[model samples]
Each structure stands twice: as structure tokens, then as C-alpha cells.
Target: MTAPASSSTTPINKQVGFINAFIAATLMGFVGFFARHIDAQGDFIAFSRMMCGGILFFAIIAYKGRLLELKEFKLSPTMVLSGFFMGNCLSAYITATQHTSIANAVFFIYIGPIISTLLAVIFLKESMKLATWFALLAVFIGMMMISGLMSIDSSGLSFGMQFSEKTFFGDMMALYSGVGYGLFLFFGRFRTEVPGDVRAFWNFVFALAGITLLFVFTKPTISQMTSTDWMWWVGIGIVCGFGALGTCTIATRHLKAAEFACVSYWECVVASLFVGLMIYGEPLSSAQMIGGAMIIVGGMSEVLISILGKSFKRPDNVTLKAGSI
Candidate 1:
């Protein structure tokens, strides 16, 4: 009798991927907070970050003559339009953070996964098993538990002095921002006929160029921006270039969609840590630490449950039921 073939399982690899995704998300989470200090205005901030990131990417692609990758994709126009929409969506998010508390913005913004995932199921006909649906719920609840922020901006300062001060307008902005960004993300996932690498690069480039034209019309002179401001803009650009574009693309290769979404709460937790350590240097609040721990446990539990369910089920048996997503 032939020896049984060995199964390949890599928990360590998966965990590494999770860490990568967490870092990416955490870096991205700071965008809203950073935008608060960008004096160029939110729309301009969006445009600048894209333009700077695009320029950096374009230079690299051009130096290596990666234009062929772009030329291979005939749907560059539609993809770029999608990117333009995404850039605007990002602008709206920065504005939302300004208008509302970070907690409200971050929390409401995530509701997009719910919206976009449903849209995907409805329009793209993507389906999940019952277990997956439960997993989704678990992941969502875990995220909410992780981001629990009842206190008003850690410090008891007045609304104007703090960034996370609760506001109705900010809440609305964050909600809409999440919905729009969600549409951008979940909608694009279905249209995978186009190369993701090409779309990611060119879409941002086109969006930057388009937004730049608009900026020119609105306020041509940017003389007010100092060298430090440019440095910040470049930093933001690098944040998008590597954090959003490079690292996320790499992580997606190793992560499933559901897993990626579920693991992303780590970003919020990391953001909280960054705030605690770098900006504030204040001790971690008990509520926050507990909340973060719960979120992680919940997300991991659901993922483990799904994996175990699949593992334990007979190969021929149907492991999942309908209405899962």
C-alpha cells in the first residue's frame, strides 16, 4: 500500500500574515488622526497623499519599466474611476474624523463591511455557509467589543481640545465614509478579471492627476506649506505606498477575505497603542486594555471554530449551510 500523503498546515505562517495585516491596518488607522493636523484641508489632503504616493510608485514602476503590467490591463479607465471615487471617499473620512470623534468615525466606518459584503452577495452572487455567517457575526461583535470607547477622549478635556470628542456630524461623516470605502473595497473584489497590481497602481495615479487638476482650480498657490508640511505629506504618501498598497497586497496573498476582515481589528488596537505610547505616553486605560483583549479573543475564537469545523468534517460531507453571509 502506498504511504498516506502528508497534509500541509502552517499555523505559524497564518499568524505571521495576521501580524502583517495588523500592522498595515494599524498604520492606516492613523490616517484619520494625522489628517487632523494637515492644514491643506481634507480634500486637498486626500489629493496630496495619493499624488505623493502615486509619484513614488510611478517612479519605481517606471524605473523598472513595469508599464507593461499596466498596459496589459485594458480596464485601466474603469479602475481609475473606481480609484477616484475611493480617493473622494478617503477625503470624506478625514473630514468625518474632524467633525466627529475617532471612536464614532472608526466604529461607524466599519459598518461598510456589512454593507459591502451584502452588496457583493446580492450583485456578485457570492455565497457563504451558515458557519461563515456566524463567523462574520462573531468577528463583527468582537470588533465592536475591541473598540468599545464610552469615555470621551481618555482625557476630560473640552470638545475643541480633543480629537475624539463625540459629535453628530462626525458620526454621520464616518458612517458615510465607511459605506463609500466599503463599496470601493468589496465591489472591486468581484471584478478580479483585471490584474490587482495594475489596478492598484494606475488607479491611484489617475486619481491623483484628476484631483490635482481640481486642486489647481480651487487653490493654485500652496505657498503656505512649509518644508515640514511637505515632509508630513511625504510621510503620508509613504504610509499609503507601503502600508496600504504594498503590505496589504502581500497579506491578501496569504489571507482569505473573511479572515482578513476579521483580523483587521488589530489595526485599531495598534492605533490605540500608538496613541498611548507615542503621542500621549499615558498609561493604558483598564477599559481599553480589556476591550482590546476581548476583541482579539473573539476574532480568534471564530476563526479557530471555522477552521476546526472544516478540519473535523468528512471530506464528502457538506460542512456549511445556506444564509451564512
Candidate 2:
């Protein structure tokens, strides 16, 4: 008896997805600010985030009387895999932040969009529009500029930079994080039958398990952590963990893998601006400023083109489920 979602509503849903993804990226940007304040190791920070977020999600589901949904939910391999990837991604990103400059870590982690785009094209069989390619190129070039790989000065534009031996490990970890994040996006595109909250809950659970295992091996001392450290952890857990992840899950339900990945580059721009200007008191170079603008423009252009370029066609494999905020 219920009417099917019309083509008109499809664009609106996609817009909503873009907005939620943008918000998630914004919340994620503040993660470094909280992580730096905590004296804990990356493993412990990640573990705490997952634990707290999982608990918060559980509480919300219970409050909404949606516990029945979990009871009826069947576990899927894709969901488990996605959750594990998310755990690894968070852990590696946090570790990278501790070892390398925020700019470098962010640059490496943002390679996720590229990875996701490729996987979506190959596996999801999603068509890549010319606009998407242009947006991706712009974003990649912007990231290069921001990472100091490409720079413009009074002399001219230069390419390449010296690598630091000290940050090599962290750089690798960030690259791994990007791969994990890409996989997370890819897998998240499947298992559409699961409600967003239920998926997020399991995501937290598996991520917590994975990080806990890592924590057991690393065994970083936590005795030095002050009350302030605990407070920051709780704040991050609530904001970036619960808030950001929840919105991101909702976004996955609405956007295609490649589309979500492209819009998610906003995270890098937000992170770079926040870490560079606010926390580090570092002045933004002309190149960095221009790079950030390009990223913003690229992301926005992708969203607009997706909405306006063609009629919405639902994928056969993916069910466009409506998610409650």
C-alpha cells in the first residue's frame, strides 16, 4: 500500500546523505585536538572510543525501544569485516597522529577516497562520471600541495620533498588506515537490510574487540594519565565516536560508496584547518590555503553534479533504506 520513493525524492535523500557525511567529517576533524590532549597511547584511545561509543549506541537503542531490532538482526560477514576495517583505520590514524605531523597523517589517511573510488568502480560496478574524475584529481592535487609534495613560491612551483626517517612508520600506518577506511566504505555499502543503528552498534563491537586485542599486545602504560586525559577521552567518545560514526552510518545508507568517499574528503580539509591554525598556531602557507579551497570546491562540485547531472537510478544490489537521524 505504501508508495515507492519517487525519482524526485532520490535527489533529496542523496542531499541528506551528503549533509550527514559532511557533519561526520567535521566532527572527525576535531579528533586530533582531543587525542593530543590525552596522554594515552593510540590503541587505548581507540579502544576507549569504541567502547564508549558502543555503550552509547546500546543505550540509545534501548531508550528508543528498538532492542527488538537487534534481537531480530542476523549477523553478516560484510558487517563484521567492515567493523574490523573501521577499528584498524581508527587505530592506525590515531597512531599516525602521535608519530607524524597532523598534516602528514591527514594527507595519508585521505587516500581512502581514492581507494574507495577504485573499489567501487571495480567491485560495485558503479559508473564513474567525468565530473567525479575531475573532482578526484582536484582533491588529489590539493592534498599534494597541503602535504608539501607540491609547492608554489616566489621562484616557481616545485615537486617532491624529503622524507623523514622518524615518521616513516607513522606514514605507513596512515597509509594502512586509508586502505582500511576504503574497505570500510566498500563493505558498508552492502548489508543494507540492517538498520543504521544496528550496523553501527556491531561496528563498534567488532572494532572494540579488534582494538582490545591490539591493546593487549602493545600494553601501553596508562598510569601517567591525568583526570584531564580521562575527560578528553569521554568527550571524544561522545562527539567524534558516537556522534560522527552515527551520522556516517546513516550516510552510508543513502550515498553510493564512491560518492560517500568523495564527499568525505571534507574531513581532511577540516582536520588541516583545525590542527594547523588552532592547535599548532602554525600559519597557513599560500599553497596550503589554496589546497584547502580546492578540496572544498572539489567535494562540493561532486555533490552538486551528482544531484543535478542525471536522473536517480537505484542500484539493484543496494536498497535505499530510510535512516532516522
Candidate 3:
């Protein structure tokens, strides 16, 4: 039997989605750590991630007695398109990193949120609240700070950065990755009839296919990987791939695209923290601290406002029934 659409989400469900999104973001933050330890190329690692994650996802469904769901799964245009976009998002991002500076790649990749927000507003007709606008601006500024594109100096704030033609292809790839990411988020919401698990599984399937094609073209040295490398690849698959994207897929069911995009900024913040504290052992710069705080505040602004607003209006004697939610 097909899973029903989870369109009528309650407040409690939204809160749960928020929590899952947060956890997913946190897990995604450690991806860099795993990538650093793996001796494989970016595309190969991405391939391994999709391969292992897809297998694990299938296993989970079987364990849950939902394997029959796959038998009825038919390819929809939305599913195929979304899967393609997600695949490109992952592979293009890694390829971009190999060609350009990490800062440039990250800055461009995170632009996906802004694109997603715009697409949601235009296509999904989701209303943009005032707080959401402010949050978006704050998060954008925070990203600029964290990415080193906007810096504060004794002379004053400087905002200009130059790019070289040598990295032009990489920059374009990064921008394409952002577009792919945005499109994936949009299409994820577009086809809510599909269960989250099924969507996620197809995502891995298409992603693996795309990455494998890339491998065929680039011919990465996958044969050189050792047992330790394989272990790291598996870790990346289980943690960043399955753990993060699985929850993220679920989150899209309860949250509007824009809201989810804002919440997803937590990944950048957590990743920055991981790099500064765990990987590099470097202290966070003033800009980073400010940026991180802004991201947290901006991301939580709507939820916090909603909670506080409810508290003021809710009666002390009122009790919610189990069925009310």
C-alpha cells in the first residue's frame, strides 16, 4: 500500500520536524571530518555514500515490513527530476571543491536556500512572513561573514572579492550545485504524495547513478582505497548520507520550503564549528562567532516567536487532548 500524503501537519508535527531538521543538520556538519579522513576522490566518496546509504535505506524498509511499497513505486516526472537535481547537488559540490577555493564553493552552494525560498514563494504560493524576511537577511549576512566574503577590519568593513578565470569552471559548477539543491527542495515539496522514505531511496538511487557516470568519465582511482578508507566511506554513508538526508526528507513534509531552508542553515553553523574546534583546533574568529549567533537566532526566530505568542494566549487551565494535535 502507498503511504498517504502528510500534508495536514499539526503544530506538534511541525515542532518534531524542526527537531529532526536540527539533528540532520548537526549530522551533516561532520561530513567534512569524514571526507578529510577518506583517501578517495570527491566523486568516489559521493558514489560510496549513495551506494551504502541506499542499501541501508532498503534494509530499514524491509525490517519495517514496508518492502512491498517499492513494488508499487512508479517513476513520476517529479521524482525523476528531484532525484536528478539532488544527485547533481552532491556531485557538483564535490567537483567544485576540487577546482576552486573551499570558501567560494561553500558560499555558492549555500545560496541554495535563497533560491529555494524564492521558488517556494513564487511557485508554491507560500506567504513570506516579516520575521522570515528578516531571518533570511540575517542568515545571508551571517553566511557572508562565515565564508570570508564580507570581513570587518580596522579600516572598516570590506565586501569585495575577486575570482580568477582559472577557477571559472569550478565557480559555475558550484553555482549549478546551488541551483540543483534549490530545485531538489522545491520538488521534494512538489510531490508530497510519495512517502519520505521512498523519495529518499530514489534520491540515493539516482544520485548513485549520476555519480557513477561521473566516475566513468573522470576515472578516479577507486582501486587504491584501503580497508580504512572503505570504513570511512561507510561512516560517511551511514551518518551524513542516511542519517542526515533521511531526516531532511521527513522534515520537508511538515515545514514550508522557506522555513525548512532557514532551519537548514544550521548545517553551515555546525560545520563551521566542527572545522574550527575539532578539525583545525583553531579558535573561532570574531566574525565567525557573530555569524554563528546570527544563524542560530535567525533560524529559531519564527519558532521562538510562535512558542512565545502561544504562551501568552494559552490559558493556564487549558489542556490539549491526545486527538487535538
Candidate 4:
């Protein structure tokens, strides 16, 4: 009844996980588009996302006659903690978008990778070499450029002062979201024994609880939404909220924390593509073009190095698995 047994992941699973993570990232890229269509307060949207997604997840398990699986494992405190962080991440991100520029919000949320990297190194004992650090630096620079901050002069301190007072709070919320995301990633890897679905289900349950509590406190709105609004919320819940988030959690099973951190940058790149070509119908800015190129270069460098290193290792483990990295 509990989660599936924890087993050594095969090369195939790792590769699948890698693909899933990127796919999830791509799906997440369109979140803004959906947000534009959904007419609701951020907290309400956050709560609805968790509640709807969690319900659907459980519904799937029940349909498969796997509902009993919930009873097999007593939910751990860590699971509860992970859910709280996950909910906080979602709430903060949604609210951040309301207050800050999309670019700034996206960039700040990605600070999760750096925090995740530090946690993985200290607690998970993930190994890293100088090359990886250099790659991370490249990623950071690329992020700055993509966020449209590369042109700012730090000496003038004008950039810091430029933010409106109202937006400053949003920036902090985005930063907090990143920390919550880092903690969520850390706790997600705490128990490999749990199947990704089981973990995701419980995490959603707790996230729903937290978000619902927030909704109760905020009372953002009680007016009836149109059918179109309902449809948009449903799309977001099914696609971005459940589908994207579920795959992200599933990825933790096969990929190490640090590896996932490296891969997370793809979200920004993917989002930018959507924003530029589809939504805005604007050409890519020079900074965006340069930044996107660097992000790809840096991300691919790390992935290639990790994959090739693992593939060329001792004869005991010789495989050119794409996700082995």
C-alpha cells in the first residue's frame, strides 16, 4: 500500500528522468500565458491549483485501484515540510508576478539553483569539480543577461534604487520563493523509497492545505468567475500545476540535486522564447539573444561533461546514457 520499493535506478530511468525534467520545464514556460487568461488573485489561483491538482492526482490513483497505497506508508514530517515549502514557492511566485516585471520575477525565482547547489554540496555530499563551478558561473552570467540586468552599472547603485517601492516587496517575495524552492528540492530527495507519484500526491495535499489557509486569510474574492475563467484555471491546474509539477518531482528520483539545479535554467530560456515570439510578437533583444546563447552553452557544457565522464568511466560502468549525468 505504501510507495514502490526504492531501487537502484537503471540507466534508462535516468535518461527518462532527464527528459521528463526538460519537458516539465518546457511546460512551465507557458505559465505566464495561462496566468494572463485566468482572472483571479494570486493566492486564490495558488490555492485552486493545489486543490485541483491534488484532487486529480488522487482521482487517478483511485481509478487505478491504488488508493490503498496511501495507507502503506505513514507520511513523514519531512513530507509535510516539503509540501509547505512547495506551497510557499507557488504563492510567492504568483504574488511576485503581480508586483514585479516578469523578467525580474523569473530571474529571481531561478536563484533556487544556487541555493540548491549549496545544500546539495553540504548535506547531500554531491561531488563537483572546478569545471562545474565554471559552468555555474556561466549560467549565472547568462541569467543576469537574460533578466536584462547585464547592462546596468553596479557602481552607480542606480539599479537597486531604480526599483519602485511597491516592486521591492515583490522582489523579496521572488527571492523567498527561490529559497522555498531550494528547500523543496532538498526535502524531495530525502526519501528515495517513495515513488514519485506517491510523494507528489502527498506533497500536493499539504500544499493544498497551506494554500487554502492562505486563501482563508486573504479572502481575495468571492464573486463568481465566468465559465472562461474556470476553463483557464482548469487548464493551468491540469497542465502547468499538476503535469509540470508532477514531472519535476518525478525527476528527483533519478537525477541528483545538483544535476537538476543545472537543468533548471532551461525554464528561463523556454519562457523567454514563448514571451518573445508567441505572446509579445517581438524580436529577441540583443541582450536576450546573447543571454540565451550563453545559457545553452553553459547548460550543455555541464550536461555533456557529466554524461561523457560517466560514460567513459571504468569498465564496470560504461554506458553513454544521456541522463547519467
Provide the TM-score for each candidate, comma-separated: 0.71, 0.87, 0.88, 0.85
Considering only N, C-alpha and C atoms within 3 Å, which residue pairs clash in candidate 3? none
Off by over 4 Å in 4: 1-12, 152-161, 222-224, 311-325
Tens digit of per-residue lDDT, candidate 2, span 110-207? 78778877887787676888888988888788877766667897888887644599989888888898899888877777765566788789899998
RMSD of 2: 4.6
Worst 10 residues of 1 by lDDT: 1-10
Q: What's the best-to-worst order under TM-score?
A: 3, 2, 4, 1
- Two-way lDDT contest, 2 vs 3, winner: 2
Better of 3 and 4 by TM-score: 3
**Native-to-model Cα distance after best TM-score fit, residue 28 in candidate 2, in Å:** 0.9
Off by over 4 Å in 1: 1-20, 32-37, 76-78, 129-131, 142-169, 209-223, 249-257, 298-325
CA lDDT, candidate 2, residue 191: 62
Query: Scored by CA lDDT, what does every candidate get?
Result: 0.57, 0.78, 0.75, 0.73
lDDT ranking, best first: 2, 3, 4, 1
TM-score of structure candidate 3: 0.88
Residues 1-325 of candidate 3: C-alpha lDDT, one tens digit per residue: 1222333222224575677778878887888888988988888777766787689888877777776666565767667777678777888899899998888888888888788779878867767778878988887788777767777889877774558999999999999999988887777775564556776788788877777777777788978888999899999988988888777776775567777877888887878887657778867778877888888898899566544554435643433222211
Cα deviation in Å at residue 229, candidate 1? Answer: 2.0
Best of the candidates, TM-score: 3
Query: Candidate 1 or 3, higher TM-score?
Result: 3
Name the regions of candidate 3 deviating beyond 4 angstroms. 1-12, 305-325
